[model samples]
Target: MVHVNPVQVIVDPITVLWLNAFACNLTKSLSTAGSAPAPYIDLRLEAIMPRLVLETTHDYPLQRDRPSTLQLQTTRLLVCNYRSPDPTAPGSLAGLTKCLERLQAGEMAFGSDFPARDGDLQMVPDRLVQHTLGKDHVQPAPADVVASVPDFRRDLPGRLLWEEPRDVVFIHMDPFWGDFFGTSAVRHRPVPFIDAIPVSMWVYQNRNKVASVSDGRVSDLTMVLHVPSLISLQLNHFQYLFLLRQLERLSEMSALLTLDAERLLGAAGAGSQCVSAALPQLDISLLMPCLLSSKDSSGGDLSVFPDSSSVTSFQEAGLLPTRVDSLSEPLAELGAGLSQVKRGLNSFLSSLDSALKSPDDQSDTMSVMSDMSSDSDSYVLLNLELDKSESVDPLFVVEGALKRVPSVEIASEVTEDTHSEVSLSSAMRKRDVISALTLRLGRVELVHQGAGLSSSLKLNMRHFAAEQCAAIGWDEFQAKFQLRTKGWQGLDVSSPPCSVRLRMDSTFVPVANQRQHRINIREQVSSELEVRASELELALLMSTVTNLTDFIEDEILPVPLPMELYLEHIKLRLTEDRPPNNITSPGVVPLDLRLPAVHVTRDGAGVFTVQQPTPGGAGAGTGPSGSRSLVDVASSFNNPASGSEGELGRLRRRCQLLEDQLEQRRGSEQRLSQLTALEARCREAEDEVLGLREEKEVLMKTLSYLKQEFLRLDTAHSRRTDAK
Candidate 1:
């Protein structure tokens, strides 16, 4: 007989610490191969329960010995309580029932049609109704004649019962005698009814299956969430129904995310080369249509289920109150969030398509490579094959295997510095392979198809936080980068290894530039690198710098830098690959070798520098040929007829002078416009001051006239004070 110790769990308000220890122990205990029944692990809660905590961590083996089933049942009870605004008003159970009864009866008050007298032809429009008493008016009904009538639904106009605010606002009226007679439309606001309703929800993860696919196992999960029929006591029903609708939408989103687990897992490789024609291509144009369906011209389509008329009829007939579910407004919002994620995915897909269409997108220009995808299998072709098309959505079928060809080998002679050739195969061999031996993603053909096709993405930006002053958000502010194929050798195939370009697009809308900004960024990145540390770190560092620049533009800076600074169309190439163009003389080092906008030099002292390339000319003091100092250029200005002054040189000098003058004129025009605006404001201020002086003079004259009148009246009254 084996006795297992109880797992002690100390619960706190927020974090749970000891569960990990127990999980470790349980995992260790479960690993032992034993025929005996699994030991029953008892759970002991030692501390006060804050809320509810249910955390499951599973690390399944590559192949299971037998099929395992997990059943989880979670029940939650939510009780909402509210007090009557007027404590003195009666709120007994009988009175509350009477209020509901009156509410039901009131529905028919406007819904029913009055019969015509003497068969007279009468045309009555629903929009207009008579309020006056008629000769044929019957005695008031028993329900209306009751002296102690509940003021629940009587004060509200009969037509606007459904349109009222979810939470009732009770206005307190005084018992003053004059207050009642002052207004003809005296309203008797109801004391809020009993609002203590309990809502219970039972969630069951009943059906889940794990089946083998061509490359990996596919998991089918089904959850049934049941909320017991709730009886809304005429108050807070909308709030309750809206909450349940939100829960339903959340469950749907969770199911979607779970079903597409592969996409989430391999999000880093979302931009892998689209060599497979079998994989379903996403039509990004449909994103707008999807979102637009959730809304209409009337703010949003908040249509009630079962039809509002039917529900009203049911209520008027004194049946059980019908539960009318509101529209999926929250679901629309969730779709909006998903749209942001889809935009990022679209960027990745679009870049892959573009790269496939245009192979020469990358150039051998002398610029520092910004986010060059040298790490991992960024430049390797991932063969994706879709299996079980009937069960899964096409977009979620992202399973694939990495092709093990003679991996990319960097050319040693590409740079002047003698660096060893690093093969992609050697690097992959050194890295930890996760289930690579067991799970094999199948291959797809048609890699060379669809060449030279135009793949342009439409840009549609949504300002989600437009109402906010200090902050801005964009749903489509995404950056797409491609991986360049470095020189490779020792390949059995004729063509180079398909350069893979993966996108790590942001999944959330970033908000910045608040009045008081406080961010505690804790980046806990857990990743396995399949490439050189230097290359991977450089890529990550560049990404971090890009994010930092975006933050600066969004928060600290009032206006972003010029469009050229954005680097939207700029390409980054290695300096060694692209040497200076005009190297006329040997051993002549060019001052500017077409370096990146910002270059980080690696020496004993690491330093950062911005490279501002001077205009290409001998007189610019940097380029090759006709090397003249600044003093020599200055002397040439005085001596126009110098021997070196050819027609071409003269033309170049005039063009340079004109360019300088043009720049100065532009600056002066900008400053002059600003000055004009300031001067116009100053003139307006002077005009306002002069108008104030005129008004002051008029007031002074009026004050003098009033003083004179008062003096005369005082004198007249003082002489004959007894006349009153």
Candidate 2:
């Protein structure tokens, strides 16, 4: 295999940079340099205060209200350098002047402080995460998974204690630095990246760059955002044309909405033309104040609206102001727009009220539904999800420095093969502890040593133009990044090479309004069905139907009606109903059926034939007498009175004869029933006899096996005794 540099250059730099310290975990850095495959890939994780940000479950299933936050854990690896002339030489980080130390000590400088909220750095969880949620959209963590986690109690009470480091270390490496244990041939490296799909964007931050790296591959995953978060992003680029389309839309909305002519105010030109046609360019910031105030004025969760005192001024030029690009400025712009729209709408409504009061103005109320309302609330709400996220990571920082200089002994002085395949695992576990403080927050770069970089070690990923990509529909999307494995934070394994699993929760709004909440929950259920269907696809499960015509509705009766059986029933019915010329294949009719009726009701609309009465006593017609001859009297059977009296008498006589026959039949039936009972008894007896015979056979087999075993043991014992 051809070896290449293990580097994935991000087109958009500044994609990742944070300095929030929620949980500070420190570990000894175990870094060593070697030939082809290295002993340790110095994967490190530094804790920074975790952001108290909002996380929306994309359109994925959501339970009711659950805390919507991205809890990130990282396994970040850094490149180590040495102070010696040979940069590839092995160096101990044991208290000697370190490479990282000198960089921290002003020997190097990149972006002084990585990017973060420009003002006072709030301690993680120093404040409460409060907002009025319409309903709960976030699903509870799976119970089986929650059980093992200490952080997840039945009740999450008290302050959320989080002290995470800026980031952490992660790399699949050769744990057998000196030991030749696991062959790279049979078993490939365990790649959680290939398996643990970074299906969502925040996962990159919350889980610290999740990947599904197999022996060699990374899956394609697109970033997702709810409607709200998307608006927030568009609003961020108000000053510059950083993005297309959205900037154009904002510019158009600015030009049109600013006008207040009397004709426009009255909406005199409104008819077949489009209203808010320029919405595409409307500044999202302008939507906040007017829209948000009226919406939650039932005094719901206005925590979304920043208090006037709390909201810093916008666009007022100053050194600090220029740099302060937190949610503040965008929020301020939003508030401004909300104020404008509210004023315009309120005035419009007032004017409309006067027109309605005037009897001269008989206007229809139906016209108002299509117009009015603004994007502020949605724009503001989207910010909740966006706040908890990070976009555009800055992966490179130009700071080249070395910390340690390791002295190497000549080849002749070396006695034992310490670098043998049996002992390499010891080299990878060596670690170091160091402390560094930050002045401000922005991207900081670090590098560590690796094997001469010959072997193929890669963390490659696919990228796409966000605008060109198609979404998974509104229903399929979820905004928040869920670390599939909670505390999928830290992992170490003996590396002849070890693999780890990184599970991630798919898209779901961790929180949403009531209407949105239901949709989200349904989405989760759908996702489960999707996963189950995938299993069925691979397992190749199938079902067959039996006896289709018998509609017993017997679920799990171990058998189903056959399709052909039902088809035959339909075929028969069709043939009976149709003329001889029309008979066709049974497949033409559908066979789905329920319980059938004993006698089918025939249609009374068809014609029928009538039978004449026979001669007998009480004949309706008598020769030369006043009696009616019914047999010949009624040529039409439709008339009731002219019925055959003679035939009726004959029918009575026949009935009497039938009664006698019935008595004989009853006796014969009783005898037949008795014979059937005897037969049933004989069958039962036969079954019992068969069961006994099987039991006897089993017993005989057991007895024979025991006898054989006993004989074998006796022989063995005798031989041992003779030997003794």
Candidate 3:
């Protein structure tokens, strides 16, 4: 008998909920009004400082207000370089020279913010802050720690020291590096570009000081890229076009990161003795913005209003300047823009597909090396997840990237080994750079502004060499992928909750040049998929259903038509490892099979009829009614009438049965409708919250303006008093 795990049933939902809540909390306004409320910056500093002074200081743009900020903690090697306005200055190249010297000497301290800096230069925070800001977006405050004393605790006179530690390093370079930014990869700029893009590196260092040359340990390095501007772009006209544009920039950024990491690591003996740093594990998250300001929605100037409730609330609160009655022009433009975006996407995909299918020897390995490593015996893994409140769709950027597999082979110094069976081509084919992949997507709606999507994903890969191969062994793996879509539209089709699961044990063998090689033929894999009926329906199905049948049904029946496909075991292998030359029979064994069972629920009371399959490939035959179904056993709902039904009289029994049936029907019908309404209400509430948040941010920014106004009023009042 197989025991079921209850944790598997609830883990995904719980994970999604927890992650969504965590992200929400992370993106909230940092400037809240309360004693010991949260870590915040002093606005009074800004109230006194001049704009030019603030601009000249370190952390210029991101000095004060940043709401869309997230923090991470991990040990990473920091490599940084900067440019000076006066190239002829005495210490113009001093910082960069010092950093290079320290790296070569292995005297680089991890705690140091800028090892390159001298005592003369101002000290900045030792963290990287990446922003995908629109024109109206505020720069985030640098992750800085300062001493504070609460008014209530002033009598005790104790200092509250807040420590904010970030492991990543930001290297600000010259804006006009042009082709001199290390790699040949070029950034395509349709829109105006930011002055300079800061490059961040998450470095992994071998900790053992006394380790042998071949005894260095390699752990999977994960990179988390958070871009909150994607959500805002989806509401605008050129959503897809902008994404395609940003994807190119992202590729360029990744390439620069790889080159910088290699430079730093190579200096520290990471790439010495034939052991090289592998590509990092990429965990990319596209977070939705907390506030959808006018610039975020309209792309540039004109603002297309969101929902009615939000508009009404904003107008009532005296936030809106003017109300535009007609949406036809903007809506038409949006439609036209969507079509253009679709065409552009199709063209790009086609070109990308052709590029992958054809071989181009002229393509340099250095360019791709940014996103992927070409080091000997290295592995790479990528995980891209986009989360919103209303929709969760598959990211096409990942799909496009996956289609063109990067070559992970690096030519090493060849040693004469004539007897060895491993050739260069065979080794390359056997190497699994991307060991495992998982994609979870929901419906992506471009036109709907009120809808939101939330998603979470992780990727991991391992590289094995002769020294570490013994430690790598086969282990049992169990994973479940789930997809949930609401208001899913298609050609006369309906969508229900779908889940796919796999259980297997996999292993790898170290082949030529001590590279990790995947063994695919011997591994036995088990797979399962389940689909259930739900209230969600497609609009296109209504007319088609009416045309197909005489009965013009207004609603679909929430039938107990739960379908499941289960494959017990699958494996591929030869009959013998070694065969005779005159072997007449190519020995192959027939697969052993077991009869599958079928179970279905009859009504909403969790009652099921378990049936055995009939001969001649017929459907499941009826079984005894009393056989308890799997649904009943796994149901989370508490049934008060169950186990005590016999105690009731005939009249009570009849009433109870009717009541239960009515309740179930009502619930099934109202659940989807109620969810839709609740989601709309949630969006409205979020909009109000965001409006208030933006208002607070504005006040903080205009603190200096308020001070100037106060001084002018005081001067006028003093003159009037003197005249009197």
Candidate 4:
């Protein structure tokens, strides 16, 4: 009677982690006889053991045996506790029924219509809606309400939810709050809803369910990034979705960076320059690994980086190649065009706003609406892709087997600049194998097949990083790096790997949402200001279209959206937010975009909502799109803007405080560049000083010898001459 110990399991609150146990029987030839009968082992939940502390040693094998070796097994079944499943269950019989009634009734909302990746990934999930209908208190149903079915897992994992003998997986919730699983807490590892989960299931509204290729579900669940307590949440969700929207942003960023790198190449003089000027706060997943793509009909090996080698710079990584250089003219033109259009639109918005503010502007509202009829209606949606049909990447053809890398828990720790420093100039050595494996990812072709036509990636890491160490501030920022070295290599975006040219391009598509999106902009304000005040309906629409396009295309890994469809699933709680007292960066500053912009210390999690007061009027006020006249104007023009802003009186004075802050940031960037150049000059001067010092020592020794000889000669010559 073999007894397998109860296995502990845990699920992360942010991501789903499914455990798959791998098993194989060992067989060998018997000495002086027929081959030993092959043994069979089955991978099952029975062999999973959790939190079993092993000795502090290496090379440890699990040695756990499977229960169903060499034989067929029966399917596992679950015994759910809540025939009226507990509130603990996300979508059990009772729990889901209650949520459904509330959603259909419209008392609570599912909010699925809201943009999935539109700068609100951190929206708190809604509360569970519960209603009690006493025999005496039942009410009649509304005719307009519609109900929705909630999603649930088929079976639990690891014998978790049974009283006597039940299926393994079970969850223990804190009643109205978080969940606790096995010996592990539920925050770091959340149980995945399996069973009914189809191979092509994707996230929709708030829940995970089966999806088809045609359905435009978001790609890769959600984007993951590490904020250094130096950046804000606005970039992660605002400005743009970080790392996740790779395909859309890469090529565009590449074009911009290429132009900047070219212009700065000569002026910065190689010794002094900056790579991130124009596109400030632009995050293109830095060096993410996408499939190396091509234009050929058949798939072929297309390795951008060799397994053993690394990349050094954007140039060596392939960005500054002749082909990328050819793109100079187009990129400059596009940038200029976009900048002009944005300015023109802003100017038009401001002019109209100021006109609306006039006392007589309201009197001729009808005339204003008539004037807005000529605007253009085209809306641009980004549709990034690999630029070609499905083709094999050369990097994957390493033959026989891929290199095996060991796992290690990676977390960065910031110390108060301790350890008194060691002379590490000789502590490190470069890898030759990495240098030999380098490749320049310089191909740019068009893709016409597959769900098709998006961008792809290629790279060589080691050489790239080594060559660009100065740009990364290697001398001062070298953390304690150690490795077990079982072929474990990484291109950690938090710390980008050595060398690689990065290209990011966003595709533009047209979209027309039947429902009108609303924003209010007066002639007196800037569009940037308008965005800050009202919802950025255009930005949201554009982002959603781009995300949907990427989801339909193979640019991102196909998967279910991470959240539960239930709106309550969104009101998710994170760690408590505190003031920026614990922040350590010297550059920390909070600049209010509004008037009298003041610098405040901001923290990593400082992405709270700011509700500003809007202009209100007598009678029924305008809707989200502002006055109807402006909407009509834009719609009539097919959506184009008027131009120009009047001279700013005292009310429109310059924000000197804000300007100071920007200047400070620019100065810091300049200082960083200057320090790099100064270090090079110092190195050169050190070589010269050392050589001169060596010569001085030699000359002094020779002079001492010559003086002694001179004394001897003078004494001898005086004696000889006197004697003669």
Q: Rank order by TM-score, top first?
A: 3, 4, 1, 2
| TM-score, predicted candidate 2 vs. hidden true structure | 0.13
lDDT of 3 by residue, 1-724 (tens): 1222211111132344355445444434222333343322321100111111000101212111111111111122123222233535211234333322322232112222111112211111111111111121223433553455563455432223322212222222121111111111112111111111222222222233345233332222222111111111001112222333333333333323333333333332122111111121111111111111212121221224333222112122121111221343465477557656755665576457545642453232213223354555553433242322114432222334434565455544343322322111112221211111111122111100000011111111221100000000011001000111112132111224322221111112213432133222212111111322112211111111222242222122422322232221222111111112344655323233233333333442335444322221111222344333555544413564653443355458668889999999999889988999999999999999999999989998799789999999999999999999
RMSD of 3: 30.7
Model 1 lDDT, residue 129, Cα: 19
Q: What tens-digit string does per-residue lDDT give for candidate 2 at 188-277? A: 221011111111111111121133222111112111111111111111111111122222333222222221111232331111110000
Assess each prediction's global lDDT (C-alpha) against the native: 0.25, 0.24, 0.27, 0.25
lDDT preference between candidates 1 and 2, better one: 1
Q: Residues 503-575, candidate 1: write the lDDT tens digits.
A: 1111211134411342211111111111000111011112122323432232112221111111111222211
Query: Which tens-of-lDDT digit does each residue in 1-724 have in candidate 4?
Result: 1334544332221121111101001111132356453222221222212222111111112111101011111122122212223654332434434433422332112233212112212111221122122121123433443343332233322332322211111222111111111211122232111111101000112222133122332221211111111110111121122123332333333333332333333322111111110111111111111111111212211222222111333334322222322443355455556556654655565455644464453333221112344675643322121212134332222211111222334444421211212111111212100111111111111111111112222111112111211011111111101111112232224322222222222222212431132111111111110101111001111112233343334433433221101010011111111123344623223222222111111122333222211122111121333223444434535733321121222124346656888999999999999999999999999999999999999999999999999999999999999999
- Each prediction's RMSD over C-alphas, in Å, is 37.6, 38.9, 30.7, 38.4
Q: Could you tell me every candidate's TM-score relative to the true structure?
A: 0.15, 0.13, 0.18, 0.17
Q: Model 4 — TM-score against the truth?
A: 0.17
Clashes of 1: 1
TM-score-best of 2 and 3: 3
**Residue runs of model 2 more than 4 Å from their true location after superposition:** 1-612, 615-652, 660-668, 717-724
In candidate 2, residue 336 scores what lDDT? Answer: 61
